[model samples]
Target chain A: MIQVGVNGYGTIGKRVADAVAAQPDMVLRGVAKRSPNHEAESAVKREYDLYAADPDRTDEFEAVGLPPAGTLSDLLADVDVVVDCCPAGVGAQNRDIYDAHDVRVVFQGGEDATVADASFTARTAFETARDADAVRVVSCNSTGLARLLAPVAESFGVETARVTLIRRGGDPAQTDRGPINDIVPDPVGLPSHHGPDVNTVLPGVDVDTAALKAPVTAMHTHSVNVTLETTPTADEVRRLLADESRLFLIPEGAGIDGAGALKEYAMDLGRPRGDLWENCLWGESVHVSGRDLYLFQNVHQEADVVPENVDAIRAMATDTAAAESMATTDQALGVGLESRLDTDTELPDSITADD
Target chain B: MIQVGVNGYGTIGKRVADAVAAQPDMVLRGVAKRSPNHEAESAVKREYDLYAADPDRTDEFEAVGLPPAGTLSDLLADVDVVVDCCPAGVGAQNRDIYDAHDVRVVFQGGEDATVADASFTARTAFETARDADAVRVVSCNSTGLARLLAPVAESFGVETARVTLIRRGGDPAQTDRGPINDIVPDPVGLPSHHGPDVNTVLPGVDVDTAALKAPVTAMHTHSVNVTLETTPTADEVRRLLADESRLFLIPEGAGIDGAGALKEYAMDLGRPRGDLWENCLWGESVHVSGRDLYLFQNVHQEADVVPENVDAIRAMATDTAAAESMATTDQALGVGLESRLDTDTELPDSITADD
Candidate 1:
């Protein structure tokens, strides 16, 4: 069995640990926590072997009734692959440590693009993760854009892609962020850096991205406009998006208009924490004028990348093909099994349980 | 004072009555309802002179503990302009009645493009509403697109405009209608007829619009993609949008993301029914790639056209100029006063009370 260790226990880290536990072919070696905080307690509650990133902070865990399993060096030596969920820029700092241990690694989106040989977002360019010593999963926004753009790019050659990201202020747990009653331009110069992040995963497409952080923290909604090389009918575009398993095309009449009802639908389906793992696209909103395709979709900022990280793990450690790995990931996590999981369905034809 | 009568006390009529009441130069003559329903009772509570559209149903108001209102003919005789808020096709029937009384009329979007002399969306084409015998206000969706596009068209000519309308199933009070769980393609045709509605107002620009109805009632979100005649940077486009009084540019870090939080912001500011009179545009979402301009903004279906109706009243009945009429309407309604209305403002500079 493949052994995996998580180096951080924050938003993405805790989820990575749980996802590793769900994998049939993987055994979670352990997880590393910087402080003996509430999250450290959670790591222990899941029966994960806990290690302290700093040797001096090991006692912090012991004082909180949870003994540390080992030091970060020791954890690195034991696990075949260490999924680095450390804070931004810290991944680059830990690059030397990971190389010293000669352990394979997977980094989150927050890390700079250079930390990994190539940025990873499955389905869009899953093969890019293959045989790489280090891989970084693209940010939630990039993952969403890749997932959406890949299908279109494949169906019709894209000449130019433009996206406006309506971002949430912070994760639901992040209470320290501000601008509670105003909208400001973040990194307000030119094209946002998100386009380059998306390019790391999908380089062939010429893309421009702009973003705004809103006060609410539910999910990020993307307004995508793609100018394609070929002109397809609106129906053709709708069907193309509906075919992708990772894309949940919200059907009309389904009362699921925006992110609020989409979240409510997930909770109604008994999803853990009402998390919608798939990119929620309003199918009826997909329209094609001339060669341009326009649509609005919501990406659950915290949860979307969870499945992508799992796929990246298999891509790195195993010789699994991109399609096969994605299929296995989807089946294991129940990613595209909306019809079977949903007890109450408003649309007879809809395929996702997240509604 | 310009006297206006509203025929049909449904979603659009009640708001029109309230807006007319708030206008400095306008007085609401009365509102006509077919039956003494809950909405009609609301009209009475607001002190609007309620009239019965159906002469046979005059007793319905008295039976519901509400006093009788004059007949439709009597209401038409009193008001200089009759804003027809009747259902689809019903406005066409009422057209003859309005003409016989020699009173000017304003029709809602539900009526076809040919229902009036010309469809009007103030600011986009306030001149079209000028001294007309009859005028129909473009849809909430049209109003939003016109408001966003007019600036772009004026500054940089618009080659093409493509929009995808994520429409609400009904008004907040409308609970009986919906797909309940699906997103279906409404009017499953080429353009969904919204483009034609836009054309009736802005004839020079080539626009393509598609629409789908979601089970939401709060508001309709529009995904707009416009290819400009000249290529401008993202910064120039953003500054242009921010200058429009009718457009509220939701900046980055303001934390107001989705329709839910937007509604919350409105409620917090103590607006009646959490109504946002202006189009809520995510400022940071405005981006330019080559010549393409992309944006995402929401149109509050119930309240967006309320201010427009008042402007149309001034345009048709009074000798008020377009700019003057819009300014008077904006001030009386307490619009452009976000900073003042909001006790807790993240934006230190905004003066509008209705953020």
Candidate 2:
């Protein structure tokens, strides 16, 4: 079994730990906590070997009515991979921790793209992590764009891709993230840094992105406009998208609602995470009129990226077959990739990379 | 045969003319044009009586664009009803033209609610024009909210309805509306006026609306979240919605896109107006999770209000039975009501108010 350790236990971290527990080939070696607070106590109850880093603060958990756990150094000794689900600015500091222990570390979406030597969004940048010891997952917006753009680019040569991201007010944990009641033009400019950020993973794609933050928490909706080198009918485009496993194409006559269908369809598909994993596609929603086509899809900001980290880890395990493994995983998990059905129901060892 | 006159030969005016001409009970009396411009010439070539409204003026088209064939006074003499497809602010000025000619005129949605004594939207305010000789149609956003909200409210007792309107950027005439590159907030406030505006038609419902304008054309997409007065299953709500005739419920398993299916569904239905005479509900898109239901629906701003204008005219033609006729037309049109069959059949008497 592959030994996996998590270095943070916040909202996304807890989910990553839960996901690791669900995988058949993975085992939780241990987890690191920032403070011996209430969250740390809760983690301990879940059979997680919680640990702290500061040597001077040995019994912080006891002072907070918590059980005693080992130090971070002791936990780091045995784990093969440590996922740094730490807070945004702080992940850069923890890079030294991974280097000292000589173990691979995975960073969350919040960590800046510059934090890691390589960024991992599964669709765009998983290959970059093949030789690196640490990998940072792209932000939710970048991940979503990568997923949608990859298939469209592959199917039709992309001349230009433009997107407007309608983001929610805040994550449940992001108390400090801004104008809560009003819709603010985030970045307030064209070609938002998202295009460039996504390029870190997908180097050659020329894309422009814009963003807005609305006062709701359901999910982020993207209005994407792709100018293809060759135009395809709406039906043809729908067929391409519907062929993907992670993408759920909503039928036109069904009168399905947007994110509502997205969450439900994801849940109904029996995804491991509830409405948190997978992307929802409205099949008939993609409209090709003249040279233009329109579509509506939803991106669950937190859960979609969790699996990308998993895929990036596997890609780093070997270089010779990294591209093929990454492509296979994207086919399995990325939205809008055509599903390939073979005579054999199960993938062989040649295709499966142990992360 | 009822003689229906269109005063403008613009995009909506031409469609209105076509819709009226298709009906057996209606006769296309003639179309008025301010100038013999290319579009007006096209309307004339279609064998519509093309009369220059203002021979004395050079830019006759601008002055008489909405209801295109002739001067308001000229159309009043022969036509029983006149559709003021005129530009915004011009509708109010032409109100006297309808009054002097002693002809009932139907105004487009551009004019505010205060444009006429009564406003007609398929959603809430259709009844307000029951006895009035002249009426206004509510904007596209109100029309969409009314259709979705009425069903959800009646079945689940919606505590509050909050909606975010993703409006297409350009006017129908503007060609660049497609391939939207940016998403902008309508304004920086909660409870946008769109929800309040809907109350005029709905009477006693409370809704909060926020709008964002994106650079795409075709239709407006709304992301709505409703807090129910009582909890219910998503399937129950979807069933309740699917029962509505004017609403073509997009099915679940079939992959469908939004406006693309809606427009095609309307066309296939042979709807007299081509698009829906009422709002199009997204059936498969609706999802319910623990009393919280989500979905997205499309509202054609220009074409949807056309039929309501017809209904309002039918009411004015017989004032003693105005309320009765309004109710009849509302039921027939399935406004503020639900009908089950997903049949694509057009009403026999479906025509513009000019008829």
| Residues B69-100, model 2: lDDT tens digits | 45546666898888777656666777776788
C-alpha RMSD over true interface residues, model 1: 16.9
* lDDT measured at residue B175 in model 2 versus the true structure, 0 to 100: 38
Error of 1 at B38 (Å): 1.7
Interface RMSD of 2: 27.2
The two-chain DockQ for each candidate, comma-separated, is 0.01, 0.01
Please write out the lDDT profile of model 1 over residues B1-355, one tens digit for every residue. Answer: 9988989876677678878988888888898887654345456656789888888877655655666668999999998999988876788899999999999999888777788888888887788877689888888888888888888999999999999898887654344568555677887897878887777787788899888888665678989899999999988987787788888876553446567556645643446656688999877678888999998999888778888888998998877888899899989886652321211112211100000
Please, what are the lDDT tens digits per residue for candidate 2 over residues A1-355?
A: 5678887765466667766665555677777765554345445656777776555555655555444467777877887777877767677888887889988887766777777778877655666787788888787777877877788888876777788888876543333445555778887977688888878777677788888887544468888788887779988887787664555565443223555334333332334333355565666568776666578777776567766766766666545354555445444443332211111111110100000
Once fitted onto the true fold, the runs of candidate 1 whose alpha carbons sit more than 4 angstroms away are A1-355, B337-355
Give TM-scores for every candidate, taking all chains together and pairing residue i with residue i.
0.50, 0.46
